[model samples]
Target chain A: MNFNSAAFLVFLPLVVCLYWLLPFRARKYALLMASWFFYMYWNPLLILLLLASTGIDYLCGLGMDRFDGNPGKRKLLLCVSVCMNLGILFFFKYWDFFGECVSGLMAFCGIPYRVPSLNLILPVGISFYTFQTMSYSIDVYRRKCTPEKDFVYFALFVSYFPQLVAGPIERPGDLLPQLKKEHRWRSEDLKAGVRLLLCGFFRKCVVADTCGIYVNRVFDRLLQANALAVAGAGALFCIQMYCDFAGYSEIAAGSARLMGVRLTRNFDRPYLSQSYGEFFRRWHISLNRWFTQYLYIPLGGSRRGLLIRLRNTVIVFALCGLWHGARWTYVLWGLYAAFFVCLESVLEKPAGKITERLNIPLNNPLVIFTRRLYMFLIFIPAALLFRAGSVQEVGQIIQSLLAADFSLTNALGSLGMTSFSIVSLTLTLCAMARIYDFGLYDLPDNGNRTEEAGRQVSGVLMVLVIALCWLALLATEDAAGFAYFQF
Target chain B: MQEWVVLRHPELVLLYGLALLLCLMEKKWKASRGWLFYASCACAAAASAMLILQGADLREAAAYLTVFLLLMPGVRA
Candidate 1:
């Protein structure tokens, strides 16, 4: 269910209470049941997919463990597990795209064959949970982690409701042990978790949702809009996305923490990154780490020459983009990032030397100011492809950006904002800037002094933000589904 | 036309100027970073309120500001 919805508002607290009240051994079972119910809330059919995946991986992990000294048998079991997981993912996610391509080719060749569409529903969180399950089997095969003997705990690790839907993508090693241990609710962890949840609600409902209204308006009519409107849409799109995804992560991490589980953090102040490499390291950290360990390193990583490394980087990102969706635009988005990373790597040495020679203070306010402006300019256009519905739409928006109608008056006039809308927008922007500047991600480790102060401040602020957000949401007409729900 | 320009963009400039001023004051004040954050949040809320009331075309501007907020000094790792 959407976090913004009234149903989830009721569902979250009920599940949390049950989780804490259950005996340690029963807690895993409770979670497993809750997670199944949660997935079924979207579609009852999806529960079958989740169960099938879980059962396959569970048996695979045991099979791999049982065949432990024999390399050939183990490899075969691993292959089976990989095929099953990937097969499900491929059929559900990519079958239509492949079908369309084949159909188009047949039509061109004057063949009367038409590929029939199954109209299959893409299961929500399939990509995330599939990857999570795969990691469990792979880790078992590699002997990095033993097979989880307790079926219930292993199932809960795979399906933990908070991070299950949109994940921080927990590793078997990181998450499994916690499930095996007895969980007693810590007052501190509970307070901290609740605070983070409140912060997340504020970011999502107050900031992200508010910005989304304007972004949708501008993007929906990009062709008719002036350059200013186009630019405004592009810029707002970035913010809307960040708040939407990051807000979800915060809620997930916070909720999990209340249950005494520490999920991986998903974002760092990614935008503040001075370089593309730094940005990737900080942004969607779990996914980047996943690609690095499972994909990049396995593909020879940086052990080869620089050129090979660059090629590998591009390949990884291209897959990363494709992993987000079946669309060509996502593929282009992946290539776009690959281009930046390649360019940054090539220029790293020369750029460093240039900066050093110029003797500009690397962290000087002026240098920081200019670098931020340059990065903002670079980020928006690149991000446009990801937000656009199609390649053509993206092109139209870019073309509008370069057009000659650059009047400030016409731009503001077209937005058709009420006075209240204008005030609300300004307040939202300022609030976002402040949160970003304070390094919201750094709150967990804000030095000793800040930490001590943070306990009291964050507690009070957290309560206030949550109450305010809940109230705002209640007053609003409806909660918008998360922007990333489609993926 | 000129009045609108003066009213809208100038308010934005002033808001930014205030942000910079707050940053400068933060350096001198030695307050906890959390308080600074809270203050900045207050300023942002105020600015957002103004934008909402004024009916400014904020989606794009807010988007740019969000990116700036993200990649800029405060958010820098």
Candidate 2:
């Protein structure tokens, strides 16, 4: 069930209450069942896949632990778990795209071959849970973390409802230990959880959905849209996506926090980063770290020669894009980001010298503002690459942009919003989002009594505002699923 | 559309009005915020009663769920 869906709204509180009320020893079992039930509520049969992944990884971890002295055997065990999980991910998620590519190549060669598609419904959370379980196996093989002996705890870690579908992608070391502990009721955790839930719902239903209304319309009739409209639509898509996925992450984290389990932070004000390299570091932090650890560093990250580092960067990013979807658009999007990020890495020293000669402090507000706007400008084309239907659609957007029909009225009319409403609503959403995001990084200091009280009161006020807007959005717009769920 | 949006969910509109009115009262009655909260809560309860009296249909029930899940946490805070 989606976090914003009606079913999940009812499901979350009931699970939370049942979790707290259950006896200590039985809580993990109850939570495991609840997590499975949560996944099964989407599609009952697919729960088998989840169980298989969990069971294989659990056995593999145990086997690796048993053969700790035999490095070859441990490696073999890790490979079994990785191959099993990746095989499941591939069959379900990537089979159709891969088949189509092969068929196309054969057709182009003077031979006729067709790889029949299974036309399967890609199971939700396969990508997320696969990586999570593989991490457990890899860490075990690396001797970084012990294999979890408790099947129930390990199982729950794989299929935990909150982050199962869309994730902060918790590691075994971070989440498994918490599963073993007792989580009693705490008012503070509940309040914080509610705050996060409110903020998340606000981001999803209000800001993101509002943007979606406009973005979807423009994309649906791409031919009718001029350059300005497409640009506006692209910017809105970026906002819609960030708020949508980050909102899901916060809600997931908040749901776990209600049970006194904290998931890792995902987005960290990525739009405010001063450089494209910094932006990648801040955005989808868990995924980036995963690639860095498992892929980038393994290929001799920065330790190798410059050419190797660039090659590794490109390969990692290309896979990253493919991870988002099995589409050309997603691959281009990943390549687009890698291009800018690599440029920044190569130009950092030169840019530093220019900044030094310009005699401006890096912390200067105007300089920061310019940097943020530059990054956003860099982001717009990447967003187009991400949301476009095909390479031709992206080309059309760029061609129209070059045509110079940059009329504001055409843009607003195409999206069906007046200047006033969009601006006011955008400002309101951004201000509130900034307030909450700032709190995520730097909470109010407890030592300052009055400031802390003010922070609490402001939080209450923000939640109330978020609730009102969230309700209104539901009353008006069509509620869409979280954008990341497709992956 | 009007009936779907407004006629079926008058209580939601009314309760939201009460919530915003209470927020405005917080500024005017700083020393009596607690009393204002309790009083606003009574109005909200009465608004909910009005909704129940209107009977339960699927669409209206959906509206109620939104208020309960999305809006109530704010009211509680």
Chain B TM (all candidates): 0.52, 0.48
> What digit string (tens of lDDT, one per residue) describes model 1 on residues A221-313?
778778987777778777888888888888888878878887888988777877777888988888888899898999989789889889999
The interface RMSD values of the models, given in order, are: 8.6, 9.9
Candidate 2: stretches off by over 4 Å: A438-477, B1-77
Q: What is the per-residue lDDT of model 2 for residues A1-487, given as tens digits with 9 covering 90 to 100? A: 8887778889999999989988999898989999999998889999999999999999999999999899999989989999999999999989999999999999999689999998899899788999999999999898888899989899999998989988877888999998788877888788778767766776776677768888988888887788999988889888989989888888888899899988898988898898888998889999899999999999999888777888888999999999998889999999988898788878878989998998879998998999999999989989989998887988788887888787888888887776445644555554544455532433534464333433444454445445545555566666788988888
Predicted structure 1, TM vs. truth: 0.82
A456, model 1: CA deviation in Å? 6.5
Clashing pairs in 2: none
Q: What is the TM-score of each predicted model, taking all chains together? A: 0.82, 0.86
Cα lDDT for residue B69, model 1? Answer: 39
lDDT of each: 0.74, 0.77
Chain A TM-score values for every predicted structure, listed in order: 0.92, 0.94
Per-residue error at A59 for model 1, in Å? 0.8
- Residue A486, candidate 2: how far off, in angstroms? 1.0
